[model samples]
Target: MPPCASPLLLRRRLSTRPPHREHPKLAALLDVLNPPPPSSTPLPHALSSAFPSPSDAFPLRTLPRLLPRLPSPLLSLRFLLWRLTASTPQPSPHALSSLATSLPDLSSSVPLLLSSSPQPLPLQHYALLLNLSTHAGLFPASLAVLRHMRSFGLVPDAACFHHALRAAGSAADVSAVLEIMSGSGASPTVPVIVTAVHKLASAGNFESARRLIDKMPEFGCVPNAVVYTAMLDGMYNFGNLDGAVRLIEEMEGSGLGANCAPNVVTYTCLVKCLFGKGRVAEALGVLDRMAGRGVMPNRVFVQTLLEGVCMEQRVADTYNVVERVVGDRGMSSEQCYNVLLICLWRVGMTAEAEGLAQRMMKKGVQLSPLAGSSMVRELCVRKRSLDAYHWLGMMEENGVLCDSNVYGTLLLGLCEEGHLHEASALGRKVVEREIHIEASCAERLVELLKQYGDEELASHLLGLKQRPGGLSF
Candidate 1:
């Protein structure tokens, strides 16, 4: 404007303006370029996060308080499953009670989450809950869950009814069973009747069990495959041979053999009872008849017959049975041979036992621990270290460390036999794996190793004396 304002003059004038303490635009740009970092501390997780995280998994008794406390339905159900499926065979009574009592609440929450989700809640979930409650002897809780599922229009599958029936007792409980029997949604399943029959037979009430089956159709339930099987088992259990024979006839006449009706178990139970009454010929005949009906003997059935023969000290018969099982393509050789190996030892047939063991080793059959320890000890005593270690390797490969005392037996025997190399090597493995040795044996081992100039191994053996799991004398 004033001679088009010289470019140099304009730039100098802009630079000479008063300095602003805060350049809002520049500050905004700078903040955007380098934003502040978030706080270092972690955010809070739901209290239910403790599930399967460590505290609530093992020794499941600690799960009671956490059961109902979990917020999400999915979390609650997962917690319940974790507690029930834990390695502990039967959870402590306290845990069982807590789980049983909390099952209703936990189950109530499941539908809410499922309702919004694409997947619907399954009847099996309720049945699983019923099974847990039933096994815990919480009949009221079991029935309560059953009623809840029914209220929610959830029909139990066969397994679920079986679990519920297992908890059935008292007048009210039996009424509940009948109710399920008569209910239009889900009739009594074979497993359910089988459970009832088994419970009756267990309590020596065979008549009631029979009557329950006879009345199945009255309640709109069809007798499934296991129905006659259960009845046969009950009759055999009560020593009613005529009743059992009739049930088998009925099963055969009813075309139950479509799936080999009166399966291996039916024949096995009858054979066992016959053997108990000193009716070996009849038992064998039963086996022949069942085989004629296309129900071949399984490993358990054959092994059980051999067990009876062995108990009676029929050495020749036991061998023959085992030989037959082995030669027959129908039977599993490993199971038969494994049982025979134990049987030979039990009957004090040591020479025969050793021969059988070698044959088994060649065939890769692992002798079970029941006789495995005895075999290993005997082998070592005979200075068959190679054979002993070979069988031990078989046991290891099979993951069937049949005897915990085997290591101690070997170490004592090996050291005494002057097998220093084996003793040293085995001792190192035992220590590394933290297998405890007998206190007396460990002390002796430490001395022996040190005497043989294995001071390091001796120290390791000595160190084991203070550890809790180390072998006790």
Candidate 2:
């Protein structure tokens, strides 16, 4: 037989017999040389010796074409039927074998299954799709799935609503979310609704949030403690201390009292707001009120109060609060100590600030950037330049990454002490190390040098070529 005729006979046999059981070695060799016929053909008994049954053989050849034509809806139905009837179902040896034969085509099967399902897909399946869509940022597809869910007469539970709300929030389509919620005929539980409200409030849509709160009762949904806390957070976030307080009063009138006392977060929000508005006394009163309500102040709340004291320049009071907070709870957090350090420095209590820093280091309290920077400033103010430099180095050694502001403080301190050469060296080091230097600090250093009658030093420090007169040095 001619070489070409042998291949044609082998192809005819493969077309008639099962592709899987064909002579594996010989067919592999044939595939490399004489290609199969363009159209399928029946095999004679003589060719059957080389190839097996048609069932397995044809799929291997026709799969590429059939796969492209395989309707998704049909595939989904097949899957559903298989799943429903798969009691005591063992693994399909044929399916696995087919998969191995065409591994690259497996992905295409997924869309086929999804498109073919006649009824609504299962919730779990939808959830998986939703997750994929969310990760891919396919909002329109997710929304379509949601609508598909409703069309199938399926009511979305809280978790589904929560995921949808999150998707909507991410998309920044609050109006679309509200429309979906209203049309769904499904009322979200307290947690889901509160999350929606909080999202709106955070976006500064307090009016809409308040309206939602009012409408909650109409929906036969009562606000839970979490909802109240969310409202308080929103009010505080919007800088409406009065409104937040009024909401607190409403909670009390409704016999809710402050039993919830709001969490540490709520208290911190209110305290920070009061401090921002310079109502330090009011802020302190809120702290007292929180304590009276048996809501123990956490580290954050204590830190906020300490910040208020610092802002008010109440050094003695700030120290007292710090000591009280630390002693009462045995919680000497770095934030609390940092606040104390700032307060001591502002009040010119240099020794006290230094003592506090030492105590913090001994207690193993990690110093925040601001706190470490403040300590450096205090040391420099007292002409403890070596100590300041040592602390900055220690900070770097400990993996405490200092920002541009900290470098500015260090440079300013060095310049103020007339260590122009050291300051210039450090500035150059900063540029080399790619440490950001604040523009304000740079300007301030130049101004200070001019005031000290050191025009040449200022020019050198600023990397300026021409020195100007009438600079008021």
Candidate 3:
């Protein structure tokens, strides 16, 4: 029999062997642990007789390859337990990773691994187990792993704490939150505590969330703007408007310095909440208040404001809001005008929309493609195809690109209006530009030409159907 060697020597010896070939002693041990069929003595006796020395530990690297050769996972697990609980130095990170990957089922392996480690595994190993458990949707198992780490006096990293809090859902208690701040092997952190508060508040445990924030200063963690904002968002989502407003006022009024002041996101959440509750005037007031505080609006805030104003059909209010945003330079005048123009059309204010479009054009404000499309659609809907075509020509002159839908609408409208010559001219231009018409519009145009007995015009348009790039229909 080969003599017993230190783990380092065993590794060196195994490294010299050919790839995928176990050392002689390791192969014999495998045979002892999993004897051929039913011919074995008891496993403990066989293992002791084959390897008499207590120091006869195997190389960690070979464990991954050894696991598959064993007859049962339980036996493999036993070997892992023996190696983990042995008096040998802790396993290398690489070997631990290899062992973890070799296990077929992470969820099943977690419990066995935890039980086997009387001596706690490395912090990284526990962290890895926590991550695996959370990702497997084993929230209870993840919490168990967290408690196990805490019991072992391991200070889990912030990421591990975060994963635990996230998977805890609404079930995570105030004790766990306080322990992170005041317990041994852990330090109070803003992000982790904020995550806990967010989860608690979102679960409608406002009293506990408030208690946590109130106790923050005792733990050397002053609640900052992000923490307050998270609480406000939770209140907003659950329709606790009065509580949300009160919290906002507290955040703004507190003497926690600039870091705790209400920000753009804070105000935006309030505005959205107000608008959601049909309090349009109050929402607008929040916007004005936000500007007065010298906080600039972000893109999401602008979009929310426009969507809310438009949905309320507050046309005059929308114009005022647009001018306010434009003057504040929160968004470009062109961008604001385009959104306002679409809102006007959507609310059935066609005349007002036309007047706005003309004013925008005179001011050299470029119209968005959507605005142009909206104008063409409104005109055609009113049975004014001739004017739509004229508008399309004007758009082209102003270097505004009209989408293919605009052209298709114009073609069908002209055909329906009995203007075959004008339709033919537009059809040729469409083909020349290689703009593909929608399938329905193309078929309808063809049917109209055929009915008019304009065989030449119909044939010319039909030629587009054969070209792959010419017409979608």
Off by over 4 Å in 3: 1-138, 171-182, 254-258, 334-473
Tell me the whole-model lDDT of each prediction, alpha carbons only: 0.63, 0.60, 0.71
| Cα lDDT tens digits for candidate 1, 1-473 | 11233434533443465323222122222222223566342211221233334332323433443443333334455545534444435554455556666543433444443443343335555655666657556576666666666656667667766776777664357556657646736666566777887666645566777788777776677766577677667667667777777767767775544543677887787777778788776766765686577777787788678777766777788777766656655576777777777666665667778888877777777666766887787777677776787678777776667566678778777787788877877888788876767667778878788788989988877766632223222
Worst 10 residues of 1 by lDDT: 41-50
Judged by lDDT against the true structure, how good is candidate 3?
0.71
Model 1 ranges off by over 4 Å? 1-46, 49-129, 147-158, 168-176, 180-185, 204-225, 252-260, 326-328, 332-335, 343-355, 358-424, 430-473
Q: What ordering of candidates by lDDT runs from best to worst?
A: 3, 1, 2
TM-score of every candidate relative to the true structure: 0.55, 0.46, 0.51
Clashing pairs in 1: 436-471, 437-471
Candidate 3: tens digits of C-alpha lDDT, residues 34-104: 45577747554566677665244555555676664444444555555545434556555555556655644
Candidate 2 least-lDDT 10 residues: 464-473
Q: Please tell me which model should have the higher TM-score, number 1 or number 2.
A: 1
What are the runs in model 2 whose C-alpha is more than 4 Å off? 1-145, 151-154, 167-179, 202-222, 252-263, 307-317, 327-335, 338-355, 362-473
Q: Pick the candidate with the highest TM-score.
A: 1
